[model samples]
Target: MAVSQHASVRKTVKEDLGAIVEMIQELADFEGMSDGPKLTIQDLLRDGGFDDGVLSNSVPLFHSFVLELTEQIRTGNKGKITSCSSNDEPLTRTTIIGYAICFYSYSTWQGKSFFLEDIYIKPNYRKRGYGELLFKTVAQHALENGCKRLDFHVLAWNPAKYFYNRMGAENLTESEQWEFTVCQGKKWMHLPKTIPSGSKPLKS
Candidate 1:
């Protein structure tokens, strides 16, 4: 069956963390990087605006949206879209099938930009336009937030690259003189000596 036309995308609730984490693990496994999903519910709770102590007046460090079907769209139940609240009570979204996670970043050349960390739809939910829906939602969010551009990385051999290109994604590394660098594992764990308390750098 195709995705229902009434699928709804909504901001994630605090209680959605468990389901989100499960989907994250599924995505990691799909990408053959099982180690990538190190996030925990507590991490989401602490860093995802659920804890008021960490809320920033500036833009949130990240945001997520979940795709779920309204009861009217489902086969039998006639449930309406329920608004998610900050309370610990879980959302009634048994129809949830996909999610998009995004963050904002600053580019010296272009000011603010949107970074899509991950977007995934369950295999059974693929080819129903849900992924595209999530993508367009993210693009709209970027424009609404005054972002100069939206960016994300794709696996070189993944067929999704063609889909992204069809969506007008630019190959920054090939067309622009941009280089991507990453530091992880031991390299990420090790720290260089701290700078002297009051040392000034010599002019080059």
Candidate 2:
């Protein structure tokens, strides 16, 4: 049967913390950004306090229900790791075939917008229409929220550049007059919760 014939996507909630961590690790490895998870299992279990907040803004938004599709077992013949009953159960996807991490934000250029921080589908899953579905879902949400655009970035080495091109996401290169800088981790961690006036760009 065709892959799309069974194409399904569901949302997973926060209670399935282990699965979220595993999928994240799988995604990191598959992207060749890193093979081993940068975060330990413990990080997922306890890094955020019982009252602690969610994923960092720059890290791609993973809210309580971020990974709805795989977590909920709403896609394909596959089901949750916890619910499968067969001894000969098929191997669960060890790589992230498709994902979208996003948030609502105000963009000076596009007014209020839906910023899609990341979307990825494993190489094997390409041409299956899953990626298009993911995009459509996000775009639809943005429209629902009255967003003028849905924005995201793709790295230079990523193979999906051509695919994004067909989707009409133009190549954005650096311009001479203005500069873009990114600050991550260590420094961002130490910054005050609220920045004082005239503070230089601080991440943490």
Cα lDDT tens digits, model 1, 31-106, are 9999988888877767777666565334456899998865422322333434433342324335788998999898
Count backbone overlaps in model 2: 10
What RMSD does each model have against the real structure?
7.1, 8.2
Would you give me the overall lDDT of model 1?
0.78
lDDT of 2 by residue, 9-49 (tens): 44433355555566566667766766556765455434423
* Top lDDT prediction, candidate number: 1
TM-score of 2: 0.58
Largest TM-score belongs to which candidate? 1
How does candidate 2 score on lDDT? 0.57
Tell me the spans in candidate 2 whose CA falls farther than 4 Å from its real position: 1-5, 15-17, 35-97, 174-180, 187-204
